[model samples]
Every structure is written in C-alpha cells, then in structure tokens.
Target: MASKLSTTPGEILREGQLEKRSDSLLQLWKKKRGVLTDDRLRLFSRSSERAKELRFHSILKVDCVEHTRKHVYFTIVTIDYKEIDFRCTEESCWNAFITLALIEYQNRRALEGFRRHRLLPIAYEEQEESEEPRSPSP
Candidate 1:
C-alpha cells in the first residue's frame, strides 16, 4: 500500500507520492501515496489502513498557490469551502494532472445533465403527439 498505489475499481489516471499538509496544529507535511481516478482522488498513508477519498463531485476546484524551483504547492477547494493543501516536486506536475482530471470530470457531468434534461422533453412531446386523436387523414 505504501509503495504501490491502488488502481482497482476505477481507471488510473495518475499515481504518485505527494506531501499533504496535516490539519493539526503543527501542520506537518506527511508523505502520501495518491491515486487519481475518473471519479475521485485517493490518498493512502502508511500509518492509516483506510484511504482518504476526495471525490470529484465534492471538489470545487484545484488552485495552484505557488511554484518554486523544488516544489509546486496547490490547494484543493471542496464545495463546502474546505481547503486541503498539497505539494509535489516541480517536475512531477501533479497540480496540472489533478486540475485537468477535475475539469474533464465536471464537463462529463454537465453533458450528462444536459442530455437527461434535453431527452425528457423530446420524449414527452413524442408521447403527447402519439396520444392525440388523429382525425380523418385527408
């Protein structure tokens, strides 16, 4: 679990180690094995058995805070306004990967919503036309 990131259940978009700032008072950085999938981002820690899942539906956006020669710092903002900080090596570009994946997920959801709403009205219209009594075909 520490060395290999889990890729089961969902398609693996990206997998790597990232440092997450802890929510404790000290705010220490802890190394976590991260697995990005189509649905969510899973973070696993050596000390914990359960993986922390950041589902895309709950994530509002990924904000790139700063980039230095050695590291790139970013924040993941949840829909509820909670922010989680993470950083990776500058060469890794984890920020970009996460952002791209999130945007793609959002677009897919929007398209699904549009299709559902668009199809329902068309189906209703077809049903209404068929139910209407047709007079003599002149």
Candidate 2:
C-alpha cells in the first residue's frame, strides 16, 4: 500500500464496504461504505448518509483482532482509548489500508516536527548573534 500512498492530504486511498459493530446494546453489525482518505476513514450508511468518522489524528492504532474463513476483524483504538470494532472481507484488506494510511500520516507529522525543531535552533542562534555587539568590524 505504501507504493500507492498519496502525498496529497484528503485524497481517497481506498473505498469499500465494511461491517462495523454498532454501539447499541444489541451490538449489531452494520454494513457501511468505508472511504479511506489520507487523513481519516469516513463511514457512510447504505443510503449515503454520513455515519461515523475515524480521523487519523485521533486514532492511536488499528489492531487485527480476529480472522475467520470469510472475514477479518479489526479494532481501531482512539487516543482516548476507545475501541471501535470492524470487519471486512479478507481480500478487501480494509484494515491494512487504514493502518498504512494512519502510519503514513503520523510519519509525515513527525518529519515536519523534526524539520521545525532542526531549523529553530539555527534561527535562534542567528538572532542571538545578530543581537550581540560586533567586535569593531574586524
């Protein structure tokens, strides 16, 4: 999936049907149209109504919990430690796509932070040096 990773944010990475465990006491599995983007996973109902969104920034990790003859189950753990369950066909690889997109997004954020940190010290030193009195021009 790395080879297909889009550098542009908000681009659709993958789209397919995914079964998510509902929140009610019955915990029924509902089919959702899962749209994986560079930034978030948007789940829509059969009628095309927006259901739930799992944003990468809020997602802690995606865990593959179980596998059966026909489907693969996974859980998305959020930063607040809430776990959401989902399942899809093994061939669809929805879990893998979401995990890869999240990792790529996180890596990009870390790289940007590192770049900013590396430049900040140099910038600060330049400012300090300029503020210091010049030694009589050589």
Candidate 3:
C-alpha cells in the first residue's frame, strides 16, 4: 500500500503479474537476488485484478500457442508488437485475458470478434460477395 523509495507503480507492476498493479512485484524482483518463485506469482494473481478491463484489450493481443505436446496449449500475448509478453500458463487465452483484466480493471468488455473468430476489429480486406452475411429465408 505504501510507495517504495525508488519505485513507481508501473515499475513495481512489471514483475508482480500481468495485471495492472504489477509494478510493485517487478520492483521487488529487481531489488531481490533470489530466483523468481511461483509463490510470488500466486500472490500477485490473487492480489490484483487488472487484467479484466476492456481499455487494456486493444493494447493487448491475447492468443494461445500449441505446445510440443498435443492438446496442450498456453497463452501467448503480445502487446503493440512489443517483444515483451504476458505468460498465462494457468489457463487458455480467453481465461488468461479475463483473469488478467479482472485483476487490472474492474470494468471490462472483451470484443465478440476476439472470442468468436480471433478477428481484428478494424476491417482490412473486403470479403467476396459470396462470403458476405446472408439473411434467413422469409
């Protein structure tokens, strides 16, 4: 709850969790010499709920990668083409994004496209006439 002498919120957040309040954990990670542990991760996962907010969605792209083992997948997120990514090992991309956003922001709305089709909100290429949506027969 108290600010550290040498840390800002964002800086602390980087190490804590993929959630918004992760800077503190990040700061501790930088200050401490020990290996990053799962206990800390569990703590951060419980302490913050930043990953649930909608505002962070446009900036964060969440997806899943098939692992070396079949039927096993992990969440791999890239933000704004940045090299740094979020690790969502506990669940699928949808669950990861939901969990992260909840930890980060209270109000959240995931676009239908992301869940239904993994589509980009903005249109780039026009679909062929046959591909267009058709109305049900009267």
Candidate 4:
C-alpha cells in the first residue's frame, strides 16, 4: 500500500520536522557543565589525580586518537575526569585535545591494572568475526 500525502500544515506537524540537526563545536562547548574552577586545592590533593607534575594549562591541548572495535561497535567518546583530573584558570585555552589524550591514557592504565589483577579474560567476545579474507569463488 502507498503512503498518504500531507493535506495540510497540521498533518505535517503531526510527525514533526524530518530534518536532523548537525552537531557543532559551539553546541559541545555550551553542553560542558561544572566549571573546573570550583575547588582548586581539594581537586589537586586527590590521590587519584594523575596530573601531579603536569601543569593544568599544559593539559588543555588535545591529542587525536582512533580505536578499532573487535566487533561491530560504536565507541563512546566522552571526556570524564575520574582518575586524571586537571583544572586550569585559563578558560581561553580550554584545549579539548589534551582532555581526550588524558582520558585515553587513564583508560590504558585502568586496562593494565585489570590485567595485573587477573580481572581481564583471555577470550572475551563470544561472536568473534572472521579475520581471514574470503576469496571470491568463480
């Protein structure tokens, strides 16, 4: 069966606009919450703080990273300050690149810790995709 046509503006409004909004850097900047300047002394004193020697401004710079999924998976890219937290007064130079690098570095460290504790499994994924290329049959 064929789909019915929109007879009026009200009919079209029923489904709402079909357009998808593009994500922008400005949107990302605005979405950032909780200023990193709340409590400097307390933040620096945290034992989990990996940015002990590194200056907070130095961490403003970002390093590009790309990770491949073992299976078909969409990697979640988020800036979370759990292990390595840095706070700088330089709001003008809030380099997102450094944040990405810091997060990845922390992730690697966590993975290593898990391995040392025997928390990681040798074989994890059940549905392992074939890595061997299949030749076309005539």
lDDT tens readout by residue for model 2, 1-138? 765544676778899899999999999999999989888999999976856788899999999999999999999999999999999999999999998888888998898899899999999999999999878855
Residues 72-104, model 1: lDDT tens digits: 999999999999999999988889888887887
lDDT per residue for candidate 3 within 27-104, as digits (tens), equals: 232111111111112222343443232234333443444443323233323356532223333422333433353334
Evaluated at residue 35, the lDDT of candidate 2 is 89
Root-mean-square deviation per candidate: 5.2, 1.7, 16.0, 22.4
Q: What ranges in model 2 sit over 4 Å off?
A: 4-6
Residue 136 miss distance in model 1 (angstroms): 4.5
| TM-score for all models, in order of appearance | 0.89, 0.90, 0.23, 0.22
lDDT of each: 0.90, 0.90, 0.33, 0.30
Native-to-model Cα distance after best TM-score fit, residue 15 in candidate 3, in Å: 12
- How does candidate 2 score on lDDT? 0.90
How many clashes in each candidate? 0, 0, 21, 3
CA deviation > 4 Å runs, candidate 3: 1-58, 68-79, 86-138
Model 4: residues >4 Å from true position, as ranges? 1-52, 55-94, 119-138
To one decimal, what is the Cα RMSD in angstroms of model 4 from the true structure? 22.4
* Preferred candidate (lDDT higher): 1 or 2: 2
